[model samples]
Target: MGEISIKTEIPGPIARALLERKEKNVPAGPFNTVKTFAAKGEGALLTDVDGNTFIDFAGAIGTLNAGHCPPNVVKALQAQIHAYLHPCFHVMMYEPYIELAETLNRLVPGSHAKKTFFLSSGAEAVENAVKIARKFTGRKGIISFERGFHGRTYMAMSLTSKVRPYKYGFGPFAPETYKWPYPDYYRSGGLDPAELDEALLSSFETFFLNEVSPDDVAAVIMEPVQGEGGFIIPSKGFVQGVKKLCEQHGILFIADEIQTGFGRTGKMFAVEHFEVVPDIMTMSKSIAAGLPLSAVTGRAEIMDSAGIGEIGGTYGGSPLGCVAAIEVIQMIQNDGLLEQALKIGEAFQACFDVLSSRFGQIGQIRSLGAMCAIEFVQDKTGKRPNQPIVQEILRNAHQRGLVIMSAGLYGNVVRLLVPLVISDSQLDEGLGVLEDVIIQCCQNQQ
Candidate 1:
C-alpha cells in the first residue's frame, strides 16, 4: 500500500453532502482546486471527509513549504492562543511582530538597513509595495511583465497582464500602469536565447519613448520565476538587465516573491539565484505555513516614505501569524528544507526526463528547485497548447489520490509545488501517480 488510499470516489457521500451545503452558502467568486473538504492534513498528505487520503503537490498554491501542520508551527500557534488571540497590532504592538520583522530584515538578500511591515495577503503586500515605491520615487507609472500575475486587488489587477478570470469585467483599472514583454524562451520563435534577451531588454528604451517615460515610472515589479505565469524562469542576464534599467532610470525594482520566496526556488528567495538585490519585495504564501500573513520588506528609507496612517490594516500581522512565521523561518533553517528542495527538484527531473522520451505531448520540463512544471502541447512538432489533455490528466490524477494544479496563460502547464518537508516515500508515491496518469491519458489520446 502506498501513501494514497482511496476507498471512496472523490467528493464521496460525506463530501457531496458538504458540497451541497457549500453551494448554497458560498459565493461562486472563490475557487477550489479539489471538490472535497479536508478532514485532516499533515506533512504532504491530506485526508478528505470521505476517508480518502491524497498526496499533496499543490501545497495550498505554493503556501506550505514547511508542510501542513508542522509540529513547531502548531506548538507555536497553541502557545500564542493561550496567551492572546488578537491584541490588534494598532491597539498594542506585540513582540512576535517585531521579531518576525527583524528576522526577515536579516534573512532577505540585502545587508543594508531594512524595515518590514505586514499585511493579510499577497495581493495586499503588492498593493502596499506599489504605494511605497511611488511615494519614494515620486512617480506614478508602474511597469509589470506580460503574463505576470501579481494579485487581484485593484492596483495589483491593473498591473497584472492576464485578462480572463482575473480581469474580465473589472474595468476602469488604476491609471499609469503599463505592461512590458517577458521572455518566454519556449515560444521564442527561432531567435537565439541571447538575441531574445537583448531584443526584449532593448525594447524598454523604445517603450519609454513610445509609451511612458522611464522618468515617470515608479517601479518595475517582477517575479524571479513567474508562478502563475507557468513557472517561467528568466535568465540571469535578463534579470540583471532589468535591474540595470531600473537603476539607470531611478525606478525601484520590486521583487514579487509571494510564490518564490521562503526556499521554494532552491535558494531562500528566487532573486538570490540571479545575484540581484531588489529595492523592495512582496512576500506571503508560505511565509507563515498556512497563516494568512504577508509582508513588504525594503530599504528603511523607501519603506518609511509612506507617512504614518498611510499604510496597514486591522488584522494585519495578527499575533498567530507572526508567531507561526517566526517558527517557519526557524524550521526552514534547522530542518535542512533548502537542501531537500534541491533533492525534490532532482527527483522530479529524473522522473519527467524518462517520461518525456516516452510521451510526445511533453513539450518543456522546467524547474527552479521544487517549483517544477511540465508544459503540455498537442504534439511535439506542433507545440500547440493542449488544454484537453491537461484536463484529462488532472482528472485522472485526482481520482488516483494526488492533488495538483494547472498554470500558464493558456492553462496547459502542470505545476508541482509539493511540500519541502514531504517524506521520500510520499514524494515517490505522488510522482508515480502523476506519471501513471500522464502515460494513460497520452496513450488514450493516441
Candidate 2:
C-alpha cells in the first residue's frame, strides 16, 4: 500500500486547528463523523491535512480502483488537457469521447450491440438511464431493492433505500419508484436459498399482479454485488431467477455497477461473475480513476430509443475524462490487475478468517475479489447489527492511522477497498492494524 509515516496524531494539531476553519467555510452537514482532513494521496497512502500519513482503505469511496493518480491516468489527463478543453461533443465532435464509448460498448457484457453515453456523475448516469427506459418502454414504475443505494439526487434518492441520511425529510421522493427485497440470504431470517427462492420470486409475482402492475414497470435495477448494501453477493440462483422474471415481464434489467465496475470485483464487471446479463448497465466511480465520470451502456435499441438532444449534459463526455478512462482500461488489460485482485482477495479473506475465529462478533465476512466486508453482530445467535461497536473500532483504527468506510443497510459492516495497487507488505500492515482494533475495541465492547 504505502510506506508508513507517523509524524503526528491524525487530524493532529495542524488539522484540528484548521478543521474549525473548514467547517465554518463549508457546511458542517456535508461532512461525516470521524472526518480527517487530507492534504494529498499517492497510491494507497494519504498524507493528512495534519501531515500524518495513513494507509488508505476507502479508495476515495471506490473511485480509485486504479489507485490515486495512477501514472497512466495522469499522463492521459495531461495530454488531453493540452488538446481541447471543452468543445462540448454536441457542439463539435471529439475523437476521445467516441473512442471511450466504443470501448465501453464493446467491453461490457451482453452479446447484443451496445452503445454508451458519458455523464459527470453516477447519479446523472442513473437518472439518464431511467429516462431512457421510461421513454422507450412507456412504463412509469421502476423496481429496486431494499438497502440499495442509487444516488443522492431527487430520482436517485427516491430509488435509494436508506432514509435517515439519504431520504429522511427529503421526500416525498420521485413517484412510481418501487422497491423489492434483496435476497440477502445471510440475514434472511433462516430463509435458505430454497426459501429465498420462494420469497423473492413470490414478492415479484405479488408486485406485478398488484402494486404497479408489471405492465407499468420500466426497469428492474440491481447491483450484482450490492456495494452499499453490505457487499452482499446474492445467492447463486437469486440473480438468475430475478433476471428471468424481468424477462418474463418484459422489463428492462439494469445493473448498477457504479461501485462494482472497473475491476473492483475479481472480474472486469461484477455481472460477469453471475450468469444473468443485464439489458442496461450504469458505471462510474473507478472507471476513470478519480475523475468525475459515469456511463450508461446498453443494448443499441434501448439506448438509441432516446433520440438525439433528448438526453445529454454539458460535460457528459469530456475529452479529459474519456482520455483517463481509455488509459485505465488499457492498464487493467496490460497489468492483469484482475489476477492481482484474486491474490488480494485470498489474502483479505485469510485475514477475516482469523478474525472470525477469534471473535464471534464477526457474523459474516464475504467478498468478491477486492471488495470485502465484515459484518459486526452483537451475538452469534441473533446476528444483530452491532453498529456502536463497529463505530468504536473505526474510530480506534483512524486514531491508529487507518482510513476505512462502512456499508450495509444497518451500517454495521466495515467494508474495505484496498486499492488494487496496494503492496503485499502494505496489505499485511493494514490487516494487522484492523485485527488489533477489532480485538481491542470491537470484541471488548461485546
Candidate 3:
C-alpha cells in the first residue's frame, strides 16, 4: 500500500467496457461515473474490475463507517436474514426496529424526551422533520440556511439552497420555506473580518430580523459545518446566535447531521462540538454500516404530534438495517472508534495542511477530524474555483491508483473521506499518494 501501483491504465479494459454499456442505459445526471466500473471494497481499499487497487476516499458517501464488509456487520446481517426479512414495523413491531429506535433516541444529541422512527433516506427524515415541526409548532414557514444540502428527493431538494443542479428545471417546490445567511464567512455578509465576536453575532441577529419574520418560521434547519456549499465553519458565536434566535421565535431547531454524524467530524455528532442542542435531528450515512437506513430522532412531544400511520414506510426500518445498526453502535462504543476518528482526523490535518501550504492553488484547508476538505482557487484574492485543476487531479489520482472525490457547489473542493477502518499504514500510503498528485498538479499549473 506504500507505493502507487498502476497495473492498468486507470479504468482498464474491463471498467471501460462496463461504463460504455452503462452510459447507453443509465441516467447521466444522477451521478458522475468515474471509473466506468463498480467497486469491490474491503476495508480502506477498493479493487476495480481492472484489478487496480485504489486507496478509497469515497467511503460509499459516508455509509461505510465501519468499513466495507466489516465482519460484525456481515454477521449481524446473516443473523437477521434468517430470523425474518420483513414484518413491517408499523404492523408487527419487531424487536430490532424498536431496539434501534431506543438506541438512536439515546445516542442523538438532545437530553429531551426522545422518540425515533426509521425512514428510507435523509430526504424522508428531513420531510418528516418538517411535518413534525409544523404539527408541533402549528406554523407554516420553514427556515433553512443558504448553501445547505439536505437531500435529493422532491421535498428535500426544495429545502436545499443550491438552485442550479438540485432545484433547476424542477419547479413548483414546497412553499413557505425560507432561507437565511448561514455563518459562511467567505460568502455571507454577516461576518465582519475586523469586528469581534459580540458585534458579529449582532450583525447576524439583525439579518434574521430583517429577512424572515421569526414567528412565521416553524423550524430553523442548520448544518453545523456547511457541507456542500463550501466546508464553511461558524465563527464561534454563530450557531449559538442561531439557537437563541430559534428559542425567541418558538421555532424548533433541527440539525441536519446526516453528513456530520457517526464520527465523520471526529465526534458522535458535529453538534457535540457546539454547546446548544437541536430540537430534532436526522441521520443516515454510516448509521447502519452501509445498509439503506435513515432515522429522525427528536423530542417525544414533537414527534408524537403526528398521528400513528402518518409517518412510516414499507422499508424504512428493515430488520437487517436495525440489526446492523445495533452492532455498529456497539462497535463504536466497544472499539473506542470515536476517539480513533479524532486521531485519524489529526493525521488528515497533518497531510492536508502540508499540501495547502506547499501549493498556492490550495485556497483554504478546513478539517474537523476525518471530514476534511481543501478548496482550490486560481488566485488568492478572487477565491474562484479552479475546476480544470481539480478535474486533472481526480483523473490523475485514479490513474495513480488512488480514489478521492471532488465536491462543493463549484466542484473545486477535494474532500478526503477515507474509511475510519483504514489502518495507519494504509492511511499513510494514501496520504503520500495524494500529496504527490496535489504537488504535481500545482507545479504544472499555469
Q: Which candidate is the best by lDDT?
A: 1
Query: Per-residue lDDT for 11-117 in model 3, tens only?
Result: 78987888888889988787762574655777887877877777777787777777888899898899888888988887788999889998888888777789999
Report the number of the highest-TM-score candidate: 1
Model 2 TM-score on a 0 to 1 scale:
0.97
Rank candidates by TM-score, best first. Answer: 1, 2, 3
Whole-model Cα lDDT of every candidate shown, in order: 0.95, 0.87, 0.81
**Sorted by lDDT, highest first, which candidate order results?**
1, 2, 3
Relative to the unseen true structure, what is the Cα RMSD of model 1?
0.7
lDDT comparing candidate 3 with the true structure: 0.81
Superposed by TM-score, candidate 1 places the C-alpha of residue 122 at a distance from the truth, in angstroms, of 0.3
**lDDT tens digits by residue: candidate 2, 247-306:** 998999999999999888879999898877889999999989888889999999999899
Model 1 regions lying over 4 Å from their true place: none
TM-score for every candidate vs. truth?
0.99, 0.97, 0.95
